[model samples]
Target: MEEKKFQPYIPADKVVPEFTVFSVILGALLAVLFGGANAYLGLRVGMTVSASIPAAVISMGVIRFIFKRDSILENNMVQTIGSAGESLAAGAIFTMPALFMWAAEGLCDVPSMVEIGLIALCGGVLGIMMMIPLRSALIVKEHGTLGYPEGKACAEVLMAGEEGGAKASTVFWGLGIAAIYKFVADGLKLFPSEVDYTIDAYKGSGFGVDVLPALAGVGYICGPRISSYMFAGSTIAWFVLMPMIALFGSDLVIYPATMSVAELWADGGTWNLWSKFIRYIGAGALAAGGIISLIKSLPMIVRTFVAAFKDYGKGSAGVLRTEQDISMKVVLVVCLAIAVFMWLFPSIPVSFIGALIVLIFGFFFATVSSRMVGLIGSSNNPVSGMAIATLLIATIILKATGSTGASGMVGAIAIGSVICIIAAIAGDTSQDLKTGFLLGATPKKQQYGELIGVCVSAVAIGAILYLLNAAWGFGSEELGAPQAMMMKMVIEGVMGGEMPWALVFTGVFIAVAIEILGLPVLPVAIGIYLPIHLNAGIMLGGLVRLFVEKRKYASEKEKNDSIQSGILYTSGMIAGEGVVGILLAVFAVLNINTDISGIISLGNIGGLAFFAVLLASIIFFCNKGKKAAKN
Candidate 1:
């Protein structure tokens, strides 16, 4: 067997294109829409928009319709710029929402609007700046090491569009289907939006699954490996954990009594015990898994840091040739000034200290995350590792200051989270820029587009947050502050003399154990964070992939061809599902119940039919391609 050779990196100047008015306008609009949507959803559900594919699709559509003369590279540049908002928003959303939860719970005092805004701005800027140093090592030295499917797809689309080929229709069709399905399922209770079912053998077996037609489609897209990991985690939670809880643990109340399925279980008592034990074990497992993964990736992290430092010392003067020296310097200075402004935004005595901490930690984590993304790709960023780092560091800082009260502790955490988010986004954006560079997009134009996108997205996201808060207050009963709750508990316990040192150490020990077992930690951590149903859906997709792969093909080319088609079809499904789920949620929020169950039943049956058709299509395409190759 031959080892796969990596792709070579193209220079920024050679890959990027000149800036244009149309790119700017389109980029700005996309940034706002994508950023706003991501932020809104992240705040509501703790997840952000998958920007790469959507941005590519929108860019292709706009360019084809409005700027027929524009090259695919130009469109890609615009989309790359626009996607920064979503990339940044994803990071911020993950961390920032905790502030609201903490504040509501009297865990900490809330920062003023100015402080909040400044923190957000600083985080965004810092994330972008931090990625500059790692560009060479991650993007250049490790070219093609990270299979950025979305980025690659965007590049392919641009190449096709530039050649005047109409290959974007597939993307558009996928997006349209996704958006409609998401709207109905998420926005309106069109059908029984959530499906609850349970097994009784385990202590606690009852579990609820969202029959998100679109998200299921997304799982298919993510393919078997990722989907399977997710599903395995879910299975542990629902089938193993839930039932165990009902069997052994005490009776517990959960949302929507009508949705609960305790009665269906043969031994609800056994299920209860299992559920309780699993919850504790899951928490431990999550922390353990994160630490284990981080430890495993430590060598790579160190190498990346060393390389980044060396690159930064070399200076941007002679290295970056994509733009004028003066312009690059000006941008750098402006970014620095913004950072200083962020440090001085609040008059609070400790604000400067907070800012300093954010800057230092932001730099370190940004480098780590960027390199990790370059190594393992964004899907496996070890968010748990970052979160744990934040928790421990923040806890120590708060304890030292004796600011363990709700006000001080929450404020500190909010500050830390914002910084972490900024770091994560910066690294991601940097990687995206590398993709643009590879495809011959202009750096300056992409940068400008990104800024515009940020502004638009920030405004849109702010509005969404305001609307959500006003419409439905944040609480356990509502969009439950699970992540926030976890944060607060850590802070209060660690700093307020209720430290779970034993549990923490236990988690660490488990992490080491798992590492020794040679298992990937991310799946375990994710299993710990998300509910069983989500994981199950992911696993189902993986199973489908496994089955598809199991079928024998005549040749290596034929097998590879079949695999690629399966992946594409599955990717379309996931994208479709997520888009539709969001739309459905929106409808539900508007108090529109369209009796979607009847439609959903049809959809369910249709989904099976759709899967069959997709399978057949892949087989046909593979066979046709194989025959064509032979001729």
Candidate 2:
């Protein structure tokens, strides 16, 4: 294996024009699409698409085609900017919907859309600005510490374009296939659409599954280790935990009419006790995972802070060489001005107060997030940190002011979400900049490109949210997903004077134990938080990879050939499935059922078929690739 040298900074001389253009356009489009989808889905199912690698691929393809003369360094600069939109969108989607739900329920008077827009815009910009100071520390000083696979792939694509290799063709073909699959699944409903499953084992268990080839593909791409852990978590929920619930509880009443054991345990009483129990467990896992990850990364956090201070003292001039290198003082002034604008905008209710709160929290989280990126890399940044921080701060403020009613609660949640989004963006932006620096792309170009992505993303995302709200109301019954439920619980529990301390503690303990056991906390927490069906799908993908690797190949060439084929096939499956999944969710929200219920209702039979198809696809690709290599 060849060792790659690390470069801390990419001087201005190395940047090219096409990289800048492609990155900006791609970033903006992805941000809008992914961000909008996330908001829509989160409100519907409490989950969102992972846009990082997809966005990178799009940027790489567009840049290579348009700027054939550009160097890899130039294309990378574009991707750095382009990738920011998705990060910003993710942040926004994660937190903002709570406000919308709250307002709809009469918890708080709705802030004018203009006010919301401004908060989003400011948060995006603030995230970018805050990341500037930590660029060197995270990207330069600690290069290669984080295994940024997406970043590496993007860089490699740019290099391949320069070298005129077939890789670009493979990526383009992959993208087209993914897009078409999504269209058919989403637009035509070619496959049976099912979101979850129920097993009548022992007593009965209800579980949800996103069963899209895309999600399974994502798991495959994420590789076996992470996938295995997710599967383990799912197994515990379905095989162990649910079965135990079915067997022991005294209140279990079997539902005979449905042919499956639907355990009606306990009085149909206050709170859906069973659902709440599971949620409580998930919440514990989430908190524990986040806190443990944060604690473990504390040293890197300290180092990032120390480096930031030193850089700030030297001024922004030496830190950033891009054309947009405005001094920290200027950046601060611009930020303050934006804050004032956000505050004074008459369309925004409590604009000034809200802007002030957002600014303070944004700055705080930006520092924390940048440090987190330095420590864990962008792919594994503790999003739960932002969520937890927002919840705590907002709860405290609302309680202290005695405005813990629906109105106060919504206002607080909106504020917290805005801050969280900003922080998340800042952390992700810092990571992207690191990639750019190593490839010698100009910082200034990347910054501008990010702004473009933000504009496109914001408008697209806002529209998506509007459509979802207009079509389907934000209640749990209507959405059938846990996002609204989670938000409702957070607001009602803390503001309504009933905190689930026991669950929180359980989650905390679990996170700690897992970390101590030398397991990565994110996958475990996600597995615990997510439904059993989804985890099972992920496990299936991992198993396929495990089998492929286990097979004896004639030589290293054969092994490498097999691995490459697996990557391509798995990538296609994920892309195809994700695109389709999004469309299905959209249709469900629209209440336009394509009625593939028969196919979907195959249950275990359906799962088995999917497993078979995926396995066959991998094997077929491996054989094809081996032949191609021999030729």
Candidate 3:
């Protein structure tokens, strides 16, 4: 047997046009578009897919073909900068929405635009700065061992474009289709974006599916296993837990619920029961899953920390262009500056002690996140789980110091938000670095591109977030903001004495048992946490993927093309819906007449019919992708 040796597609000494003005502008624009799209999707569905591949495709189309730029390095740089927006958006949406939720509840004033932007800016810079030091150890030393699947796939897309062999139109096709679909469904209100059914006999038992293109794309991209795990969790929550509560606890009044279980059922339906009670259980599971994942990664985390410091103070002056990164000294200075900002910013709500937690956990999670994404793709990286753990610890520290109430909760979320962004961006940086390494691009240049994306994205994300909230509020039916809700619960549980510990502990043990069964717990826990309809929509997409994979193909290339086409199309769907969703939010804030519900009134039955049509369209597109790949 022969051992396969590692080789980069491009030689290390080779240089090509990379850091161009066109690349930076295009990438920055993409970052805003994708970031805005993802902010909408994550706020609605609690999951955000990677933008690297889609950005690569779009870069190829506009930068290579349209502008006649023949540089693969330029295309790579475009994706590197563009994808940072999605990564930063992911981190921000996961935790920052809690502020809006709190404001709605009258606990605190809504976080100002400046406050939001600064928090995102600080976190984005820290992530890029932290990942620069670990580049050699993770992206270089661990090369073939850690596949960095998304990065490699992105590189392949760039290379294909350079050779004039890449198919970029599928992405645009899906994007256009989905944008129109979203406008019809959400903007004109032709059919409800979500369709639900309630069982009259089984009081609290209800089922629903969000008929949105972005979620369907998410499911197909995530595939059967992960989607099923999530759906299973949703099933357990809706089918078993909610029903049991309705059966036995009918006479009892839940703490969070203002009335008896029966009365709550009549007033708010199944969603109220899950939000007030079952959501805490999901939070417990989420927290436990995060801790378990952290403990499991302890050895790796320790080794990473040791390796990082061993290279500390090492200058990049004499390194090869491809291996060059920002110096350790600059990283240290910037990190210290961020720490001072966190402590000094009154809007941040962090004291010296809180600042210390951000420093310690921020770097720690950054390392873990970057490496973990290398092993498993970013989609499965569990950034939210890590954020949960951070919030738990930070809230505890603040509570122990007597910083309790709304202020304390806000501070804890602020700290967690920065850490979340750090972890998310670090993972994204690692992936981009991997892509650069394979393509023989300058690491330092790419790092700068990432920073550029972050700055541009941070400015835009605050406005996007405020727009979405102003349009439909975070916790409303339109934008559930599930992950932020979990963070809010965790902080409240720690600071306030009104937490539902029984349900939470039940969720914790359930997660433990699931892990004992040798399953990935985070997805399942999230599935349980999210509404059944959302999970069901994702499950439909996963099933489409399963159907595609199960079929026989003429050759491996053909099979791969089919899968690639499905991914490209789905990515477009996510982006398309996101763009339109943001636009609809704008129209909403302007108080435009969007209620076409009466004119096109489908009601629930029509919604269910339209949802089936939506599912069928996904299957059709996937199969069409397979055929296109075969051709």
Candidate 4:
């Protein structure tokens, strides 16, 4: 006889109190809180923590310990709905801030709240709808092969809590430590979170790192391969490309750059060169990688749709809980309606062509995102990379068709915003579905919860974006909005009529070469795009993970257990800093200064010391996890 498949913790026929009134209300509130926190964090650092596990932990504490509720499904529903906030915020922050930056430059009027709200809402809804069809194919069909690490870990947390055997203290400890650290570093300005050093011998070359908890957490979750790829990109740009440009262009006045290289260097430093040229190469590489990735997945896409349609035709009524999804008819109709609205929306610049792009690219990235997170987890998903690709293609098409200047840029950003959110939400939804699958909750109910979360989070995200821009303008040193900067640069380059096509094409060819060598191009290209400092921080996290992995374990189970615990701690750390980051932004907006005169302020030295301390703490946590596994 063939071996049996693993069964869910709860049987399909069993009824549970899920999607209850209390669950919806609590989930909505958490969604708003987490969404706002993520918005603040993303703007400050171009990243957002995964809210699922953190939200699940908090929900369990409140529902089980405080409220005396006993339903695991109810707790699951809360997290499903609440985590949408982070995903939606990530997508919006990556693209929407460009509008605000352009407005500050007098390129166009600031996008109104209604416009922002609609774009995010539509994207979120579309993402959920798009994932509905893929649910059966990816989540159910490939269940064993694709572990969906975060989703499975979340289910484990929920189950352990229900059995009164969960360990949440690690998460709590990380949260407390990170929050206080961020407040001291960022709020009070005790020392810079980012530390840097310029190499006198290498003219334009320099080295630096952001010693923030979230970046480290992201690095650890991404593991060595992806992190290494990113770091490699950074090394190429900072070490090789920067020096080459400084040497060759020292006497030349590059186009789109008004000053000669030597003059620009004396005035603005190496960053001037990176921004004007290196980032174009990075964008080109990222765009090429995205297109290549999309092309490679086309077979999988065709297979998924075929399987989805066949499954839908068989009917889902009274089906097993693990297999059911939102009706295919409803998903199709809703997607169509949203596409129509995008075309008709006055503020959205694209006409029918824009709507078509949204539908096509939105679904394409959504498919890639869901599958990717299944393999790598949400923290590692390259949503911005995909957005970079979309913005490039959209801007090029618009500019070619005579939609130049501010209008073309807005249109490109709008299309990119939708696709970005769609990918983010789709990834989040798939993760939730995986959690539900393992826990034996209703897929349809989880799908509905995702929709509710998206709607509420969309409103909160629009408000938060506007507030952050008002407090400290995007593109300001205060809030770099790095991803938004990249998007804006692409639009300006394409439509503003002075794009550095040579640099961009160089990047594209470089990515092509990398792909031809059978290497992943997106992460490497992104490393090229982002500042070396950020990649250094991420690499440090990856190194820590490598250290943990190098140690011997009694068994694979023990190894997995140790890594899981480390993940939990890091997840908490990311959340802690994010919450504190938001509060700091609020203070800035309220005109409240938080400088403490007597506290230590050793500048870069202080940053290095703090970074060492943070690294030590990570080692401690990893070692503790190993010990716990042995026990």
TM-score of 1: 0.76
Q: Across residues 1-631, which tens digit of lDDT does each residue of candidate 3 receive?
A: 0112445666666777899999999999999987887888788878776788768877887877798878899989999999999999999999999999899899999998889999999999999998886776677766756666567656655664565423445666667888888888888888888898888887789998888887777777667877798899999999999999999999999776769999988888898888788877876787677667667766655675565555544665555666666766778889999999889978677789988898888877887777667754575566887787688778889888988888899889999999999999999999898888878888889999999999999999989999999888999998999889878877887787766668878889999999999998767887777688888987888898898888888888777777777776666676577557656644544557777788667776776776677667666666666677666
Give the lowest summed-lDDT range of ten residues in model 2.
254-263
Best by lDDT: 4
lDDT of 2: 0.57
Error of 2 at 173 (Å): 5.0
TM-score ranking, high to low:
4, 3, 1, 2
Model 4, residue 355: displacement in angstroms? 0.9
Q: What is the lDDT of residue 164 in candidate 4?
A: 47
Largest TM-score belongs to which candidate?
4
- Candidate 4 or 3, higher lDDT: 4
Q: Encode model 2's per-residue lDDT on 1-631: one tens digit a residue.
A: 1112444334554434544444455555566666665566655555555454455555555655654434565456545554555566566556666666667776566555555566567677777776665565455555545433334334444444455545444444444555564554445545533444455444435565544555455455556777787666656555565566456643543221111212343233111323455445565666556556556655766676575555556765644344233345656777798778766766443345566777766766676666554443354454544565456556766677665566566656666656766776776676566556545666555665666656665555555555656666556456543544455566667776666665556656766777888887656766665566666666666677677778887777887777666666555454444445555655665667765545544454554565466556666666666666776
**lDDT tens readout by residue for model 1, 1-631:** 0112333233444544446777777777766666656555555555554565556656777776665645666676677667776766666555555666666766555545444445555666667666654454455555545444444444544554454322333333444554555554444334343554554334455565555433444444445666565556556556654554454433443321112335423334323333323434455665555445445555765685575555555666665444212243444566567656655655332355565666666666676566545433343354434654566676677567665566556656656665666655665565466556556555555555555565555555545554555566554354543444455555666666755454345445554665677665555545544556555544555555566677776777766655554444434444455444434444446655756465445444443444344444434443444454344
RMSD per model, one decimal: 5.7, 5.9, 4.8, 3.6
- Backbone clashes in model 3: 2
TM-score of each: 0.76, 0.76, 0.80, 0.87
lDDT of 4 by residue, 41-96 (tens): 78777777788877887888899999999999999999999999889999999999
Give the per-residue Cα lDDT of candidate 1 at 184: 49
| Per-candidate clash tally | 92, 11, 2, 0
